[model samples]
Target: MNTKQMIKENNRLQDAMKPDNLSYYQDMVVYIRSSSVEESKGEELLLEIAQHLLDAQAKGKTAEEVFGSDPESYCKELVEQLPKMKGLNRLQYHLMIPWIALTWFFFVQALVGFITTWTGGPVERMTQVRISTLVLIAGGSYVLIHALMRWMKNDTFQPDEARRKINVRSMGIYMAITVLILIAGVWLGRLLPVLTIAPWVSLVLFLVGIAGTKFLFSSK
Candidate 1:
């Protein structure tokens, strides 16, 4: 559900509470009803939203009515005439895109590292740094994207997109792809005459690097 929907639903729930507490619910609903927008948001937009919600409760219809037959019209008027909806906020398409991209970027690079090392090329110490940086980026992306998804899509933490809502065959395919990558890496590593690093050692480093990066950049 969208923010507006959430606010509407929350409004309905809040109406059941004590009258003294209704002000807060209506205030929140006002902002969700807003269509004004903020190019950049700050306390100004927040306060404006707050005031509108309060007004809706004070002189406007109850929050439960946002879903009423007149709600569409009401919301339309609220958005258009309400003037101070939100400050200049631009519409964001999806927060998932960047996070998905970042995670895959690191996963691909890890493969590249394995391939290079397997081909008897020397892997640099900085390889971990590169991996770590990518992981950090992915972790941060995951946090924000997860937050956006939680607030808008569902209200809880979720794993990566692939990890969620997958069919058994799809899950199997994911595992197969992972195994293939590991096998290829191992094959390349074994092909080396002296193996600058052991295969298990490299794997351990990869795991440790990812874990450390996550811990360092953790948002939760």
Candidate 2:
């Protein structure tokens, strides 16, 4: 089955688990899914584990009895054994978020420029390319992805109430950090050299972003 189907099956199976076993099994689910293993393999393993746990439960066994007490260590071992994503696939995965974000950003800029030019706004001969803004976005996205992975790893061990609190706190911190990065990027952009971009350049950039996204994500 595909990743989505496996996940759906796992979810359906988990509904029958005893409370303690469900909690234990969910910890494994979170940790395994958070790892860098290929999605299909990860979900397949999760579904298989869910099936095994259900069978064990039917035999009057606990999840701890079946998989041992240390879910984290067991999950880590399983993740290590799973095949990692291929190089191109990994690249596409990492770039997907930032690529979509930047594309939409440039698209808005292009659309505004097109509208302004048609509406008799001043057409400038040059436009500023904020290198630092681009840098901040790319760097920030990488940091956020790693942060989320770490959060998932740690949060899996926490009680539900505590995990909810942590989620709220983490989101606040992330938003604060994003604001600071934007401020810093604006400052740094002023210190960098400006690029010469015509009034119509944003439109070109929008088209390029579309083409580049297709090329990068296209199947081999």
* Best TM-score among the predictions, by candidate number: 2
Off by over 4 Å in 1: 1-46, 59-61, 65-128, 132-136, 139-147, 150-220
Worst 10 residues of 2 by lDDT: 122-131
TM-score of 1: 0.27
TM-score of 2: 0.67
- For every candidate, C-alpha RMSD to the true structure in Å: 13.0, 4.4
- Across 116-194, the per-residue lDDT of candidate 1 in tens digits comes to 7788776664144333344345444544444443342221112356335544444565566556555655565455443
Supply the global lDDT for candidate 2: 0.80
TM-score per prediction, in order, is 0.27, 0.67
Cα displacement (angstroms), candidate 2, residue 112, comes to 5.2
Q: Which candidate is the best by lDDT?
A: 2
Clashing pairs in 2: none
